[model samples]
Structure formats: structure tokens, C-alpha cells
Target: MVPVTTTQIHSRPSLTIIGGGPGGYEAAMVAAKLGAAVTIVESKGMGGSAVLTDVVPSKTLIATADSMRRASGASGLGVELGDEPARADMRVANRRLLALASEQSNDIRRGLERSGVRIVIGQGRLVGPTTVEAVTESGTEIIESENVLIATGASPRELPTAVPDGERIFNWTQVYSLTEVPEHMIVVGSGVTGAEFASAYNQLGAKVSLVSSRDRVLPGEDPDAAVVLEEAFVEDGVNLVSKTRAESVERTADGVRVQLTGGRILEGSHCLVAVGGIPNTAGLGLEEAGVKLKDSGHIAVDGVSRTSVPGVYAAGDCTGVFALASVAAMQGRVAVAHLLGDAVKPFQPHLVTSNIFTSPEIATVGVTEEQVASGKYQADILKLDLSTNPRAKMQNVTRGFVKIFARKGSGTVIGGVVVAPRASELIYSLALAVSQRLHVDDLANTYTVYPSISGSISEAARRLHVHL
Candidate 1:
């Protein structure tokens, strides 16, 4: 297929988007395809935080860490390395990850340009509800448009007392700059971001301490899955500091000192603050343009990605939604479809597929175990341990499960969770089941390859077939 030329897209559409993140870039592509001239203003390079700093870089680094973990375990599978244990050079790993992030950002830019969307590099703000002003390195450009979208994304939430200095102290973004591994790493937060980093660094030969204000790590995730991860962390020698908060983190002469609640103190070679994120909604003229924002500063948007004001919309982490790239992309598409008189559906939270990048990933879709227990939805649930799977035994994998939730009588799949190696890949089948409203019997009757982790999904569905 021939690519659309930039000249062809230069009509008076003036569809201006602030931020070149997942939400903005995806919206630009869809709008351009619909024959609308689109302009995207990005302070950072293309692909935004999800690609340039957070997801892409972190996952690339974790890949190397995972390889090291597998190598160390090869002896258990009757394989042996040389006299020395396989070590990862942090300098090499960091360089590779940053390079990959740059390449990904460049790829996103190429895609947008190929789609005939104009790229404006600089800060963007709403001059009015229907107008956007971008301050680029060259000069300022005022865009008057009937459609405007705010997808400025977010930054890591920081505490006043514990700030990231990008040296001994770091946030999620700054950790990529490390040229050497630390002897000890202290992570503050037990949620998805915190737990993921802790798991990766631990696998990378660092003594990790995961400090949590909750009872256990991943307080927002599945309890059963959390138990499996906590057990794994224990076996991996990760220090779990639960039900406490970090009062302060100060850089020491050698490393850093963390003062926890109850007057407890801990020292580490490096500290990572992963409490959460704050949307980049400030200085965007949101309120002046009559755009309502929540107390957390996230732009308030409806199911269709519309803000309080008309002709304006918001998507992605800036909206404080699911914060997944796929969800953000879909929200962007929905926004465009609504504007262009195309068929569009509201946001369906249940159909959202979420994956956590850890040793054994935790992936879930549709209704959650917590939601079910709270009587939000009634269903028959079954969990099958991977330890009992033939393929899992062959891989020497013992830490995961495939769980299915189906409604009684009808036996239609409503929710599912997979806690296993590459659960992200395994959870797609369950995602299809829940989204298509497929019945447990249908899943059970489906053919699956023998001695595979995916077989566990079919086996679990077969067990749930009795509910029919």
C-alpha cells in the first residue's frame, strides 16, 4: 500500500493534539485515516513516557535480568556454565535499553509521519476550549480547531521528603541511567511499579528491600497471585517490609538511608521511589478553558473520553484511567470516532487486559476476584496450578496458576487470571473468552497442544464446565 503524503493531509482540519504519547499518537493516526489533517505537539520525542522512559526501557532492562535468572537456574535443568556465574554488565544493559527506547520513539514518529500527521515539538496548552497554542523551539503556533485532545501523560509521583537525585536516589525514569549495579536496592511501594522493579533488580543480583504500606505487595492485584509472588520473593531473598511507610530518604556517604515509620531505619546502596504517578495536567489551561479536573489533577473524562467541556477530550494516564497503553490507544480511537460521526463505544473497564512485568507475570481480564467476592458479580471460579501441568514440569516451572471465572448455569466466561511465565501471552485467550462471552464448554471443547502452559486454560475451563 502507498503511504499517504504530508501534502495530501494539509487541509483545514486543524485537529490539534497536545502530547505525542500513546493516546495522542494513536488518535492522530485514526484521524488522519479518516481524512482529517492532524497536528501533534510533543515536548518529548514520539511515543511519550510509555515508550521513551517507563514501559519500553524498563521492560528491556528486565529482559536481560530475566535471562540472567534463567542462566542461574540452568544447572537445575542439568546444564552447567563455566567456573564463573553469568554476570550482567549494568553499563551494557543500560546502553542497550536506552538504545531500544530511542529506536521505539523514532519508530512511533515514523508511523505518525507516514500517516500524514504533522508533528510539532514543544509545549502545548489550551488557549481556549477550541484553540491550542504550542511553544516550539523555533516559535509559537496557534491552532484553531473544533477538536482538541489533551494527552500530556504523567510523571512519577514524588514525596517532599524523599526526592530522586538520579544518583543514589532515583525514580522509575532515572533508574535507566545507572552504569553499575548496586549492592543493595531499596524500593518504596508495594504496588505494580514498585514490585516489578524489586523483582527485576533481585533477579539481577541485587539484595532488594520492598517497603510497602500495605499488608503485602501488590495490594491492588489478585490476592492469590500476590501470595505466589510474595512466596517467590521470599525464596529469592527479597526483604519484604510491610505495613510501614518511608518517612525520608537521604543520600549517605556510601549509599542512602531510609527512615521508616515507627522510628525504624534502613540503609541501602540505592533507593527507588515508586509510589505512583501524577498527571501532567498543570500549565495546560484546563480550568481556564472550563475543563473540570479531579482533585488528583487528572483531567476528568467520560466513558467516551470527553471532558466536562464540549469539543475537548482527554485520554491516557492524564485521565487517570487504567494507565495501560492499549486502553489509552482505544480511548483515543473512541474519541476520534465520536468526533467524526463514526461508530464508537464507551469505555468498558471489564474488557481491559492488564499485565504486570515480574518474574512470573500476573495478567487479568474482566471481573476480578475482589469484585466477585464483593457481590458485584456472581460466578463459578476455578484455579489450576501450573505445577500440575505437564509442560510446566518440563520447564521446571512451579510458580503460577490459571484461574477462570464463569457464570453459573450459562457457564459463560466472565473473568480470568493467569500467573505464570509470560502470563501476558497466555491471558489473551481468556481475554477473547470474556470479551466474546464464550461459554466454558466452548473453551473446554477447544483443541490445545499437548504439554503446553496454554493447556492449563483449557483444563480449567473443562473443570468449570460442570457449572453448566
Candidate 2:
């Protein structure tokens, strides 16, 4: 770890980063390694929403739900549980979930501290091109630096008609306070967040209704993957309210009442609003400091993460460049590399691998069928059902498929999608193949364990190669 001191501070370029999320902390570490004095201004915990509220907490809840789901199916694997059914304890699960989030937050803080990045617990605003005014618990402090990176991140957007009460009506962040499971849960907005919560709670012994304005759940995901998930949702007794918008929500004596666009009403013990998130770019003195922001209020950043101002940069959800923590970390690293005059590749959004953490996780990387269908890129496609895989039969898992895309003639692995349990782990090989420009033949020739779910990847590549 580097040591910080006043003598050495004058000898190196100084960097100040706002918001201690993955984007800010990661950049601080990188800049410190490059011999720059770095300081981080953060009002929240070190790991930001990814570790504290949104990513870690939600995934922990999902893990508990997944374990319960698997335990209930253990009888099929010859493990009988008599006649009584297993039940989930929401209080214990919530305690463990919050503990895990706090543990992760402390770990991140220690890592940044060990890397010699000065952390100021405060809200920071840009006062000049390289000057930051931080309002801390004690008092205001001014920081002068050669480079400034804004990674303030984002928060859940709320609607006026349907506000979260943190009880009957809740947002994604507020759901962690639930000590008792609801009798019936209503989830509005069938995007990734809504679908995940609906699936999780249904498996956790709650009647769930998923309301979607789109024609299908997960409208942005692979069409085939969405179909499989929708089927599983219905099978698990999750009521699917498709092609309807939630107009307003009001608390009843016992539960909540949600009014739909077409004058239909749905009642539930609780309602979770997962509409979307808004970037945390307001009141940062951005416009006054000459930092350009998009109409949506996200800081506009270039490929290297530079803002409109020469020395100012931005990353993470605030930049609206893929709202994933992995992408945020990469953008932060790129920003520091550019600041230190290192040879760096521009951040590529197309190469980012993302996953939706549902029962059958949906993982995707590179190009998509939509991109090829747009007539801009020529590509060949192949789809292989997991039902054909021996592992699927062994595990009684019959709800996923693998789809791959390649160049029309050359057959280079351009992009692919995986829908299965632990698909997040499986997509890495395909991501590496696409990023490295590996041919379909390369993947086909690679040795995969017999009777493994990953075999489907190699087999799909082989089929594509044969056709090519």
C-alpha cells in the first residue's frame, strides 16, 4: 500500500473522486497505483448501492429464495421431507442479508484505505474545474486536484401517483426492512428488478402478481429466455398482468390497492415499485462548473470518461453507460488510465457481459439478435435447448437454452446468451471468446466436461462450425 504525506503530495498529480461507489473507489485505487495522490468524497457507505442496498442485498434475498426453492424439490432427488412443507423465516433471512451487505461495505472501505486513498465522508460538489467543496459532518472542506472524477451513482425513481411508504408500498431499497413475509405481493414494472423480486417472493411462500406495461416479462432480454421465465412464473403461481400499466396505488385497511390503466384494480398485502432509477446528478454544481449533462440528467461522458470540462470525468450509473457495477469499475479504471497518460483502450459497451439474477439467471454478452436483425451487421445464429443436455436431465432442470451469434462467413464468436441456473458463471467463456475474437471452431475444439451444462456451449459452437 502507498503511504500518503504532505511532502509526497506536492510531488505527484492529485486526483479527487466524488461518490465512493465501485466507479469512484476503483478509480482512486488505480490513480494511487500510478503515483497520484487520491481523495474520495462519499456521503454514503464505501461500496455504494451495489454493496449496501441494490445489488448485494437483493441477491442475498434471492439466494435465500433459491435455497428454499431447491429444498422443496429435494424429494425428486430421493430426499424426502415427510408431509410437512418447508417454510422460510423472513426475519432471519433479512438479518443475514443486511449483515452480508454491511460486511461487504466494510471490506471495500478497508481496501480503499489500505491503498492509501483518503476518504472523506461528505457530499461533494464541483466548485471549479479541479476544485471540490465537500460538506462533511464537521464542516466544509475544499480539495484542490489536477483531475476530478464524478461517480455519484443513481437512486430509484418514484412516481407521483404511486409513492413508496416503506411499508405496504415499497421501493427496491426499502424492501429490506420487511421482517414478515406478505400474504400477497404485487410487483409493478416487469423489468429485471421487478421480475426478480416477484420470482423470489413467490418461491419464498407469497402469492405474487407481476404487473407489466410491456407485452412480456423482461421485454429487454432475449425473447426465448423471456418465454421460459414467463412459463416458470405461471407454473410457480405468479399471476402475470401483462400489457397493463399501474396508474396509482392507495393503502387500504389491511393491504394496498393498485389501479391499472384500464380501470382494473388489484389488491395485495404489499406492492413493490420497480419502475427504474434516476442518475444522482442533481445539485452537484455540474452545469455551473461547465460539465455537460444529458436531458435525462446523467452526466455526459466520452469513451475515456471525460466530461465536457477538460479535467472533469464521470462514470457508473451517473453516466448512463450500462447500469452495472462491473461496467462502472471498468469505466473508473479507464478514466484513471487516461488521466495518467497510459496507453488505454476506449471503454466498449458492446463487450460488457451482464446478468439478471433470477431463478434461471439470464446472462448475455456481445451482439444480439436485435442488432443483427436491424440490418447493420451480418451474422449467423444458432440456438440449442438445454433440454437436450444430460446435466439438465440429471438435475431435473428443463428451463433454459443457449444462443450464439457469429460472423456470417468467418464464424468468429460475436455474441451469445445463456439462460440457466448459474448462467452468470457460464457466460464468462463466451464473453472471453467474443472479446478475444475467438472463432467458433476454437470454442468447439475446447474440451468441456461430459454431462455438464457448459457442454451445450461447446456443442452449439460445433454445430455453428459445421454449418459454416
Query: Whole-model Cα lDDT per candidate?
Result: 0.91, 0.92
In model 2, where is the ten-residue run with the lowest total lDDT? 1-10
Itemize residue pairs with steric clashes in candidate 2: none
lDDT of 2 by residue, 118-211 (tens): 9999889998887898887777788888899999999998989899999999999999889888899999999999999998999899999999
- Residue-level lDDT tens digits of model 1 in 27-131: 999999998889898999999999999999999988998898899889888998978998889999999999999999999999999999989898899978878
> Which regions in candidate 2 have their CA more than 4 angstroms from the true location?
1-9, 466-468
Report residue 144 deviation for candidate 2 (angstroms): 0.4
Superposed by TM-score, candidate 1 places the C-alpha of residue 297 at a distance from the truth, in angstroms, of: 0.8
TM-scores of the models, in the given order?
0.97, 0.97
Alpha-carbon lDDT of model 2 = 0.92
Off by over 4 Å in 1: 1-13
